[model samples]
Target chain A: MRATNDTVSSRIEIARAELTPIQFATGLLFAAAIAFVLVFLQEPLAHDAMHNFRHAAGITCH
Target chain B: MIVDYLQRGILAGVVAGLAYGMYMAFVANPLSEYLHDTQHEHGHDEHGHDDHGHGHGHGEHVHEHAEHAVSETTTALVSIGSGALWAIFLGGLFALALYVLEPALPGPDGIKTYVLAGAGFISVSVTPWLVLPPAAPGAEQLYSIESRLAIYVALIALGAVVSAASIAAYRRTATRHPAIGVAAGAVPIAAMLAVVPSITPTVVTHPELSSALVSAYRALAVLSQAAIWVLLAGTFNWLQRRADPATAVDGSHETLTTKQ
Candidate 1:
């Protein structure tokens, strides 16, 4: 039982390591795309977003 | 084996992305636009509002609009383009996660898709929203952007962890006591939600107009996400079933892929 558990755990670890590239690419893809959205639309959208709050209090975000 | 998963993931991701993206283009975009129009007519400041709880995009992009003179078609196309990218990104990641856990997951293609998509919905939308409620055009912004973002990311991570653990726990306990397994499935999410405080309790942007608008906004947000998950799951299942019937692994072969 103990040996079996160790092997299973190791297999899972190996699988995770093997998947690192795919994981990394996916993360990078999402990060870039999201960044693009923010950068591209920030000008007008941010203005409308921040217009009404009193005191311009808290974090000033565009 | 990994290659097989990657192929399936990409294929399903693209198909589902297109479907979800189309829905956004036709259905979601117009809905948000209508809401914006209505809100403006209400005599409240005519600022833009976000669809699907994303406060950033819905606002007016005045400079770009003015400088570019972007027509409605161009705007719609841009929205579709970005929407497709988002769908692809999210769908691919979701597929990868599901494929990774495929070995341990039981059930047929249909069950598996529902579980994966539902858990995803919970992780991505439901859980995070508990902490950082959707921001509208004029909600009182009490928290700093940096702090709010940090906490929001943390909450999202926490939600993902809880969701994964819940799914795993359900899998384990399910074989022993089915009822216990069900309860176990819910325990982690309940605990997490209870422990986490709301990022901002909220201040009414417009006392009279705020309630109705916010309510509609939130409801639409939830509806949009629910539609995405449903469509994604269905589309992925259909593509998988079409590619190779034998490898249809989400649910059992007993049910039709499209039905589930």
Candidate 2:
């Protein structure tokens, strides 16, 4: 049987509520991975690599 | 599995950060260098620009350029790495904020990207700067460190709070009357501007550096931030389009009945 517009809309609503956390989690994972780049590749990047976030935030720690 | 939109957003952010960081490292002129060079020139001039190149041998100018600044190779390496990290931070920031505001965002990805990018710039950079203007390393602090930190944090906090409140209000009210939603947004914006006098600009006491140089440096700093947001919005949007980021239920029945 073909799904009505009402049926489809309700389904999307339920799916979205379920997916928000998942989407956010995926984004967070990606962010963590990016941070790992600096941590794992410490030998090549030098000191400035770690403080890049501070600079982006306009903080002058030094 | 439909493409992981959030993961792609993170990847996009990392790429944007690297792009900005590299721009900052190799391409973007370092404000500190300008300050250092100007200070050097001023000191040398005061003593007298001696005809002989050996004049710097004495005690007056002790800062050997080679000793203080890192080597070119080192600087570039550090710069690229840092750029990547910065991009990632920015990317993650937008991704989260956009996710929260996704319901309010319009469709078609094209128009939506502009709104997302513009909002990202405003919330992340503009609102904060209204209270805590961006500063270069050489700039003098007009206030105490604690005070500066407080204002910076407050401004950023205020920015986030206001945007979230305003968007939620707008969306909620728009159902009955779209104009009411537009009007509702103004309240949070007004609250954001409630205290402006408290924020004083940083002083640049370095006598040698010209105002133009200082202005240009700060502009570059702002530009660097703008670039990151642009990159994030452009790249992330492209990826999200490819992934077909799930649309949120905006609470508008008209919109609801029209699409799926």
Candidate 3:
């Protein structure tokens, strides 16, 4: 039982320890896109659609 | 792995967003409408005979009522639809942040999840709130929307900087002086507060709305946002554990036992 526990713990540690560079870059790009849509995009209809949420979330919106 | 993380985030966000929409419809919308109505009443009083007086005829009044009904339905639908979409976006961001920062953040996965959630709240909501607090519909505005948004974007970037600096500080100084690490982390925020004259420039429109009501609205907004972060973190952590057979919580798995 102890050996089994050790194996499981080690496996979990290995899994948790690493994040590849490609993964990091992908996350960064995805996050930036979401930020742009929420904060920067100014098309009239899209702006109006998200207006209430922008306000509710405390983002600066008219 | 990235796809799995993104999927979990979307699922969590949908759950939180539905709750957020309900909050906007039932709690926030009514409060804003009340404040808006009061503002118009004040306007009517000041003018002594305004557009509201023009709508007093019986036919016009019924037509106005119908218009208001339609508008209310539209508002509720918009709140739900947009709430879901925005929450999903935020959830994806939150997952990505966790993915990138997990290696640097100390502690076990569970603790790190909550710490990330707190950081998310600070970066996304609390930090910008220092300068641009959540305001009621009738607040006196000093800046245009463009200026406000520019400032907001800058403040959010600053928030991310502060979060990273604080984490780096703690990591570097933790063995020697932990308290000093905390103070160092706080230095940027303290300096900003000192330099900025009107940190919280929110002002309720006078003679129409009370400061207390505005405060309540801001408080509710913060609470709802906090709820989203909490939900995101909890859901993501649960999903991670479920996906990993080695860490499975269920007792049915013979190889992965909870008992020591």
Candidate 4:
């Protein structure tokens, strides 16, 4: 019983040690990915593309 | 797995979109309006001397046309929509990368995790500049080269600060105490709130006030944004703690086994 408890406790400690960093790192990566998408989405589509869509819909930038 | 990635990506997108939308509505839009109104009120009245000035006909006509086309609403909508789409796409990529790298990366010391996180943040913020279309010929450049350079520097700085704060907070919380980390994390949020008003110049109709206000506003805005980012970093760190697999027990098995 004592040996079993000791092994379990040691394993928990090891796991805790391992998981914390991974979680933090993963969080950072997630933040970065979100930032990238935001920047890309801001780019203006080509005038030709917008014009085509507008023509299809019977509208214009003017 | 794909569904999970999609869900996470969408969640990230929503969070980013909402945050950016609120900032624009509450902060940026008002500032833009103030600047526009002020510029109109104190604009160059002395330039009406077409009789004395050479080439006045063409110059005055061009200036008048430029002034008429300057609409704040149009710019705001474009900014908001662009922000939302970017967040979604970037969020998806981040989620996918995490899913792949989680297995191979060692997290025992926290350094590798922090580095990866910082890299992710920097890459997403700076990469879009490469593919962005050139500014329209007659349209004043939205992002000046100097401003773009500043943004790149700022993104890297912000990532480093957030990463450091997160790691420190996590380490503090892990050693059976949570107060220090919580307080440290909270500082960034508070700083953001306090700094925004200062950095954001009040739009006044007077030329003399505009320059000073703009300078102050810029400083405050940067500080406020940094604070918000730090707070976000802390919150993410806390979530990571809650999701830590070590502390969670498997209900299916009667015998407790430590699962990595």
Score every model by TM-score: 0.65, 0.62, 0.71, 0.40
Per-residue accuracy of model 4 over B23-98 as CA lDDT, tens digit each:
6556655654555455556655653322232243433222211322324555556545544454454455544544
The best candidate in terms of TM-score? 3
User: What is the Cα root-mean-square deviation between model 1 and the actual structure?
Assistant: 8.6
The candidate maximizing DockQ is: 3
Q: Which regions of candidate 1 deviate over 4 angstroms?
A: A1-62, B38-75, B106-109, B194-200, B203-210, B249-260
Each model's RMSD to truth, in Å?
8.6, 8.6, 9.0, 12.7
Q: Give lDDT tens digits, candidate 4, residues A1-62.
A: 22224233443354455457777588679778967863563334432222111111111121
- Cα lDDT listed for each candidate: 0.56, 0.55, 0.63, 0.40
Higher-ranked by TM-score: 1 or 2 = 1
Number of the top lDDT candidate: 3
TM-score rank order: 3, 1, 2, 4
User: Which of the two candidates, 1 or 3, achieves a greater lDDT against the reference?
Assistant: 3
Checking candidate 1 for backbone clashes, the offending pairs are B108-B250, B108-B251, B108-B252, B109-B250, B109-B251, B110-B251
Cα error, residue B81 of model 2, in Å, equals 1.7
Better of 2 and 3 by DockQ: 3
Interface RMSD of candidate number 2: 7.1
Clashes of each: 6, 3, 0, 13
List where candidate 2 sits over 4 angstroms from the true fold: A1-57, A60-62, B1-3, B29-32, B43-73, B104-116, B143-147, B165-208, B245-260
lDDT of 1 at B222: 73
